[model samples]
Target: MFEKDQDKEEWTLSATLESPASVIASGFGLDTAVGEELIVVKAIRGEIYAYETDLSTGAWLLSAEVSVVDSSYVSSRPWNQARDIPSLFQRVFLIRLED
Candidate 1:
């Protein structure tokens, strides 16, 4: 689900990836059979909210946020050191702005 309020310059986006393994495999070249779920929301001011969950049980795994101009990400849960933040954003979100 994605909504945009043009007059207010506000927008929200939500997506569910059922086949996260395939996507990750293609995007990062990592081979794994684990199931992962992700949800992301962005506000007009440049704050991005991301959530990761268990695909099977819908339990929350990790929650994080990042500012458009900042690379420092804050996570509500302990983050996995093996995952690279920038690469995940590029491959999963692929956010872009156009005039």
Candidate 2:
């Protein structure tokens, strides 16, 4: 995350994720956080992360993580067989990229 220092035009890197993953989807939701805003992020490979913003600090904090209890990373959300199959093939092809 980047933030601007007081009286400065440049943005500085303030925080970094311990384990960064590509964000596949995200949505805002109301949770039992005592009025805190929640942002739900579904990452690539079906891992989920929740972020809460600190109104005082202007920074996002990782409040929770939903990991797979099993070995599979596939999520339970409904998927489109037609588009999903092609996308899966594309991902496989990209993973096989070589110099």
TM-score of each: 0.29, 0.23
| Error at 4, model 1, angstroms | 1.5
lDDT of 1: 0.33
| lDDT score, candidate 2, position 51 | 39
Pairs that collide in candidate 2 are none
Clash count for each candidate, listed in order shown: 0, 0
Give the per-residue lDDT digits (tens) of candidate 1, residues 14-38.
Answer: 3333443332222232122223333
Over 1-99, each residue of candidate 2 has an lDDT whose tens digit, in order, gives: 324446733323222222223222211221111123432322224233223434554435434444322212222222201223212221111000011
Q: List pairs with backbone clashes in candidate 1.
A: none
Return model 1's CA RMSD, one decimal.
Answer: 9.8
Please report the TM-score between candidate 2 and the true structure: 0.23
Candidate 1 — worst ten consecutive residues by lDDT sum? 25-34
